[model samples]
Target: MTAVEETQQAEAEDFLVDKAKAVEVEVPDAPEEIGRSDYYTAKEVSMHNKPSDVWVSFLGNVYDLTSVVSSQSRELESDGSSLVFPLIKCAGTDISHWFDETTGDIKKYVDPIKNMMTYYIPQGRFVHVPPAEPVSDWDNSFEVPWWKDATLKVGKLSASTRSLRVKNVLTGHEHLMEVPCEETVGQIRARYLEYNAHAASYTWKALKPNEEKELVFQNLDMTLNLQDNGIADDQPTFEALGISSDFHTPVIHLYYDDDLTVA
Candidate 1:
């Protein structure tokens, strides 16, 4: 090879060596507490697509890979950025297709020419993935691949989604949002904080009729979902009867407690 070509190859090898060293460094422990729902909607996961705040769902679980991706991104040489581009492009998205449902690992297929099984990465390999062929700088000493690391898992991706309408009785304000079906009332309130800063200071309840048919507000159990608190989602029943779901959206009324604790 020419002098210039040899120099370029050496530089690429150096970059890979640096990356291998970085990979050996241990990642920080996952947070002690998430203080959020155990379930997440696809919309919620899509909001954190940036390298500085990336999240992705695979095999029904959500993982926050922001720290790892951001740290590696900062170390990338201009010419070597493409090595991690697949991860950046897939941030805040569901990548369940890339993994095997039974094994919960990246999918593999037989190599056409080599007649051997190999990892199938159509988007190109990213960090922690071993090279297709052995190289001088390649490292596989890490105990676990990022995809198999449980420490990065944050929550489960909700299997189903539902629309909820939360109305503030004191301020006459209302916000409609999509929520995970598996979330509790308390978790839902946490999600509501984005719309109302004082969501926790409000008394959440639902209006229902007594034996006399007079409507009254009943306090909700924060630990339970609407159905468990006596407000079931009847949208499916309504639709089965040929009624539009929009005609009967479940509404949760909130009464402010006049607390100033939360700004």
Candidate 2:
């Protein structure tokens, strides 16, 4: 070949070599395989030796692994055979605080002051239940009790009169009377019965001073006498009767001639 052609061929070969070096081939990531513990491998993950800060997703809710412990024995089924761990325990941080230095086992703290306000799943492990399909029907066809129609009226009284007016619109009854501006809630109950004789059997009481009662009054506007008692003045205008705030709302007991039974 001619000298010029040979030089050109040499340069082309060098160019091809540099081009191949410049091109990069990338390796794709392999598909992830499910781990043996992830499936039904019969291997149990023990929380006994785990750290107190480990979080566990149990029964669809995330829980502090250190707050609970497993007490009961559980069996693992693998390859048609059952493997039993009689004393295998899983403990969380809650159990960590009660750790016994002597036995190396967790101490049960049942009445934890800090956990009183929180919900706990107790120290036992539970099987997870799959979620079911939700029902879409939202219409309620059931009839409510007749006593639900009753309501109470609450309002504030003028300072000069020292009297408040409470009315039960359902029975067409009105109670207008004087009350001690500083009267306690207990005294208000007594006064309620004094002015309204019909209220004697109904047992009407203030849930909240100067506030509406859960009994669902037709008119919430009513005058309250602050001078009768100071007890209710500082409390919520609306309050529930009974020691527990979770009790059912107070309702007026009604009697029908046909049944004559208090409903």
Candidate 3:
């Protein structure tokens, strides 16, 4: 086997062993005295697995770590920036099963600097894996797969070719916009609500994007139910709910054209 393959295998074995050990241990409840320590109580240890080894079986191929290191660090240096070592080692082959047109996976290794995996994929590709959720002490620490960051080279719609229409459920008002195809649905939604008087009138409004709003464009047909009666201006709209917009007013369903799908 190649050196990369051998290293991956060893890492996989270590992960399984650690996983088994975790399953066998039972966590003890903290003492009533909050600050008190008990010798019998179990302590948590952060798993010490290398980022690359944590990514075995991620993309179905053992990637040459040398390539990832050479490419990413070189790119960073050319820009006169320092490259962190962990980010350099999280290299792997791109292998996404979904969205056939995507290609050329680039994986950059990143150590969890603040209990979060924060890194940029090459433009056009999205990161895949770990589901963007919080990490636990026992959770595996690995860089996302290459396919998650794969970008489309061609046959995709451009921003200039698309348009968006937004309706305010409260006032029966509508706004039309020409947006780029690359803009996220959340971005369009935010812009739509920004000028909406009912949205601004709310005591609290969520100004950021939510996970439910990040659904892919293909699933735009799904219908949503709004709460607080069918009154639009009194509460958030159905579109806001899907995107987790933080408005309390009732929302009504708003539809866009076929070409103008949700992100």
Q: Model-by-model lDDT, in order? A: 0.82, 0.32, 0.34
Sort all candidates by TM-score, best to worst: 1, 2, 3
Tens digits of per-residue lDDT for model 1 on 1-263?
Answer: 99999999999999999999988845444312214678989998999988678899999999998766865564343356645578879999999999999999899999999898889999888777777777776556767888898999999999877788999999999999888888888888888889887687788988887679888988888888777877778778888999987777888999876655433
**On a 0 to 100 scale, what is the lDDT of residue 100 in model 3?**
31
- Mind giving the per-residue lDDT tens digits that candidate 3 earns over 1-263? 99999999999999999999988845443212111111110001112124332221122222233333344443322234434244333322222332233343344335566565443343322223232345452223435443343321112222122333455444567565543333343333344454652332222222222467652222221121111111123213445567533333222234322221112
Model 3: residues >4 Å from true position, as ranges? 1-159, 197-263
TM-score of each: 0.72, 0.19, 0.18
Candidate 2 lDDT trough over 10 residues, lowest sum: 35-44
Q: Which ten residues in a row have the lowest lDDT in candidate 1?
A: 26-35
- Residue-by-residue lDDT tens digits, candidate 2, 1-263: 99999999999999999999889555434322211111110011223235333333222122333322231123222332211121123322122322345543333344465443321234331222111223343222324211111111012211221335554645656655444443432344455645543332332333333444343322111232233322223222323332442232322222211211211
In angstroms, give how far residue 28 of model 3 lies from its true place: 32
C-alpha lDDT of residue 59 in model 3: 27
Top candidate on TM-score is: 1
The true-structure Cα RMSD of candidate 2 reads 34.0
